[model samples]
Target chain A: MKAAVIVFPGSNCDRDLAVALEKSSGKAPIMLWHRETEVPQDLDLIAVPGGFSYGDYLRSGAMAAHSPVMREVKRMAEKGVRVLGVCNGFQILTEAGLLPGALMRNRDLKFICRDVHLKVENTDTAFTGPYTKGQVVRFPVAHHDGNFFADDELLKRIEGNGQVAFRYAAADGTVSDATNINGSRNNIAGIVNEKGTVLGMMPHPERLIEPKLGGADGKPMFDALVEALS
Target chain B: MKAKVHVTLKNGVLDPQGKAIQHALGSLGFSGVDDVRQGKYIELDLAETDAAKAREAVERMCKELLANTVIENYAISIEG
Candidate 1:
């Protein structure tokens, strides 16, 4: 499976996502710079990783969303290329209109950095097929702006379409407002486009892929994509 | 030419920052302050001197890059 990790100036997770992708697909992903105008046409997946891209100026992901590279990213997404956006990448995707909703600052207004359990809400997607429905997996989530918000109409539409891929939940997999880690609307932690090709989320699944890293729950997510694309 | 732009979260969207500011004011004994909503104010110095064209340019910038229209509403004012 061919994959790439898009790197913005302040993106610190590009190499980490590349590590996980290489370990899963057995091929090192090209680190595509943010200023470049095109993605390699043969790529099956493009990952926008986490970081304070553009120093979070104006807003997180706002500036990076308009970078020259994003125009190509949007074009490729239209062609059905799978895209995974994590944390700040998720913000960019929303700011770019590739995904729905907005990620606002955490309700408490403090940066939260910790491991949280996420329940796989949709097992039918390419990113979640390896997990059973409602299965709870712990992933590291670190961000100040992770609260997801959407208009009522759009929220109902996406929820009805089963576009929600994951939701923050308790350790036992119970989804409740109290269990929401970042105050995301409907406890949403991740979602896919209507076509199910683009996935964006605030949690860092790549951080949990190795046994020595304290969990292997994240490996299957990458494996599922590689298997589907290969 | 100068342009001032205001970007604010749409109504019905939760403003946690604003809420915090409201609470902080309450703690300071400032009552009757119904609420506080925080927004962004940006000033741009433009080369376009025509008032109408400068306003148009800023409006385009607001739509394209300055504001996230899905969640934000932007207003522009050109100054002499």
Candidate 2:
């Protein structure tokens, strides 16, 4: 599967996402910088890794959303290229208008950094194909602005369209306010666009790709992408 | 021309930072604070001389970058 990882000025997880892609697909993805205005049209997937892009100035993912490369990313997304955004990457997608809703400050007003449990809400999408519907997976989440917010009408529409891909849940896969680590609406941890090709999530799957790295739960996501694209 | 823009979260959207500040105020023995909402204030100096033109440009800037319309409302005031 041909893929590329977009790198922004302060993107710390770019290499991690690249490594996960390479490990799963057995081929390295080209690292595209944010300044470049063009990307190869043949690419099957573009992963926006997590980090404090543009130093989280103005707002998280706000400045980097207007960067030159994001214009190309938006173009690619409109053409049906699969896009995965995690953590600050998710914030960027929302700011770029590639995804819906906004990520606000955490409810507790502190940066949370730890492992989180997320229930797979939709396994039909490219990113969640390997996981069973309602399956709970563990991924690390480290961010301050991961609280997802949407207006009542928009939230109902997004949920009605089955665009929700993941929700914070307990180890037993039960979703509740106690498990809503960041106060995301309906415990939302990730969501996809209506076409189901673009995904924006707050957790870091690339951070736990192998069993040696705490767990292999994240490996299936990369595996599913490689399998679907190939 | 100088343009001042205020970007505030829409009502019903939770403002945790504002809440934190409110809590701090309460801890300091200040009372009677009904609610608190925090926002961003941006000041811009523009080369445009006309008031209407400057307001128009800053409005575009706010729509494009200074404010995210989905969650925030922005107001522009231009002064010469």
* Per-residue lDDT of model 2, residues A16-93, tens digit only: 999999999999999999999978989999999899999999989999999999999999999999999999999999
Candidate 1, which segments miss by more than 4 Å at Cα?
none
| Clashes by residue pair, model 1 | none
Q: Individual DockQ of the candidates?
A: 0.83, 0.83
Q: What are the per-residue Cα lDDT tens digits for candidate 1 across A1-230?
A: 89988899899999889999988989999988989986789989989999999999998999999998899999999999999999999999999889999899997888999999999988887888999998999999999999998889999988999999999999999999999977898999999999999999999999989999989889999989999999
**Model 1 accuracy (lDDT, Cα):** 0.92
- In candidate 2, clashing pairs total 0
- The alpha-carbon deviation from the true structure for residue B67 of candidate 1, after best TM-score superposition, in angstroms, is 1.2
- Superposition TM-score, candidate 2 onto the true structure: 0.99
Please provide, for model 1 over B1-80, each residue's C-alpha lDDT reduced to its tens digit, 9 standing for 90 to 100. 99999999889878899999999999999999997889999999999989999998899999988988878999898998
Q: In CAPRI terms, where does candidate 2 land?
A: high
Instruction: Give the TM-score of each candidate.
Output: 0.97, 0.99
TM-score per model (chain B) = 0.97, 0.97
Q: Ten-residue segment with the worst summed lDDT in candidate 2 chain A?
A: A122-131
* Displacement of the residue A36 alpha carbon in candidate 1, Å: 1.0
